[model samples]
Target chain A: MSDKEEREISRIKEVESTNLARDDIRELVIETKKAVEKDNDLLANKIHRSFLDNNIKSFDIVGAIGAGKTALLEKIAEKLTAKFRMLVICGDITTRVDADRIEKYNAETIQINTGRECALNAYHIHQIIKNKDLQNYDVIFIENVGNLICPSEFVLGTDKRIIVVSITEGEWVVEKHPMLFKMSDIAVINKIDLKERLGTNVEKMIADAKNINPEIEVITTSAKTGENIDKLLELMGF
Target chain B: MKEELTKIEEIIANPNEIKISNIQELMEALFAKLKNRVDNYIGDYPTFIEPVYLEENVKIGDDVLLGPNVYIGANSEIPNYVEISNTIIFDNVKIGENFKLENCIVAKNSSFNFKNLNMKNSVLIGAANLKTELQNIGF
Candidate 1:
């Protein structure tokens, strides 16, 4: 064979090998991500089982911004503080405002700043629980970051997952975010006091949530007026 | 208040602490102590513009007022006439005009187009188009 032909063939082979190596690296990255997610789920489940063994009930409350999750939590903490010892873990992209608010109710609160992450994974909860004495509190409430879409994908090993949606978010919010309802154990339609002002159809929204997840218990609440808060506490077995 | 009173009573009952007969005097001392503690805590809070951490390629438009304790992440755009106070705006966020944001955490890649809207103590995720006023004024 000629020297020129051999050199061209070798260069072609080198280019093909480089392309193959790039493809392999991409696949490895994707596989690694999936494996990490699986490990997170396993760790979350183990933590949840540990809590159950200790007879502690934990809840993960998730919702969008301005959906009244923090307000609902404040009401719950205020009502339940007299009877039960509770801990609140407030998750946000940044800032500890929610934790500071919950602390005003005399509950031990921890703030998990997820930085740029939209959801609170099981790993974050695991880190917090591993350091703290979990037996001190009978109930733990994890207020996930103010997001509807991302929190549904990450299960933080809670006994109950509550999705709070308000009338101010528009009537189609439930229909738009069905996965949150499907993953949640209870769906709270908050801000019932603004129903008249917003002209929202609360019943239809609840129906839509139920259609997505039939087993989800739907409740209407007005955190401002303190309506149905007692019923919510009762349902939570406070 | 009840909890505080209980703590004060416990303190009064202790032999190691100073004994006070009048409840009013004890309460006044406790109030002063609380005020001092609160003042110290407030002093620790980050002042606006003191801890302003901006990352790479952040674009701030004309007439934007950034208040204290604000952190603007990488590649975020702050347009004209926006007042942000005690807020953390994450990376790749596109903020529009005439918006007042206080005590907010705006997540990454969120877009906002609003005018004269006051958003306080809120977390904005994804895309938000806030239109507060109706276009047509009824004659």
Candidate 2:
């Protein structure tokens, strides 16, 4: 077997051991959504293999309108721009504001104007970039449209999935949106700089997240303060 | 957090979620069913006839008749004048008033309004509300 295939096999085994041997139906749903990106598993798997074949790392950053998805990506780009050639795809309802902001950080930025659609679709992603030569980029970050629900159901065939939830959104968010948390590989509880003033229960949100998906890794950071952004980068293996 | 689900991605990844015709009977025949869990809203419990299972944080409303192989999950609210038998409900279910269910399976995070009517042996679910959940983002 090729190196990637062996790595993929081991990864699947690791996931099965941790996730499948329990009554965690939510975890099951997470795994289910991986292949079945809205009943287009065939296409989703093809997209998955293409990324793997090219040896490129892709992540879909999901969050709300003001949850700091773009800010966090900008922070990462600043620190790792020289180390890893990166591509940032910003999805928005109409504006290219986010894409413009990220481009200033020296990482290549592509703006996807979703128009009236609330989220990004996997087929659209594949079709839009099929002709582009992705060889120069080692990592690609696709910042999803700024809504929590519309993006949860679609698996964009990325290597990893990250969800950003801010303290400003409140404590109940982690528990309220089990679907998002369950499907995510990492949860970034952003905007910690405002914690003291907001006085929201960050611990409760972390606890709720751990309770929902034991396999999910949680990171607390404030992109504005530059606090723990290095930790996030280290966690992301940059 | 920011997000969205595509049309194809809206299709259920789990085969069990497929709404087969006669799912109620299929549930009985195969002994396969859903167990609803709750953590958000709750209700009052007025009565339990026999062999009822209630999970942690379950709330039931007044004048509700339950039990005899009925299971109401955690954080689930069964409103007033509701009767259930031989059914399994999953978590965070928001139920309506004046309803009746028998030998049925209700999925998690399901909320609907049904009054003075009976539902039996069916698999019912409402898609996860990512739209409303945007509230948690303070959007």
Across A1-238, the per-residue lDDT of candidate 2 in tens digits comes to 9999999999999988876666567777778866566556566677778877878888989998899999999899998887888888777655457877888889986655454467776755664356357777788888988988989767788888899999999999889889989999999999999999999999999999999999999999999998999988777766
Question: Against the true two-chain complex, what DockQ does each candidate achieve?
Answer: 0.02, 0.01
Predicted candidate 1 versus true structure: per-residue lDDT over B11-124, tens digit per residue: 434423422334334443433333211100111122122224566787765545553345676799877667775566777988777777865656667787665767765555
What value does the lDDT take at residue A54 in candidate 1? 73
Q: Residue A153 deviation, candidate 1, in Å?
A: 1.8
Best by DockQ: 1
TM-score (chain B) of candidate 2:
0.61
The best candidate by lDDT is: 1
Could you tell me the lDDT of residue A179 within candidate 2? 91
| Candidate 2: CAPRI quality band | incorrect
The DockQ of predicted model 2 stands at: 0.01
lDDT of 1: 0.73
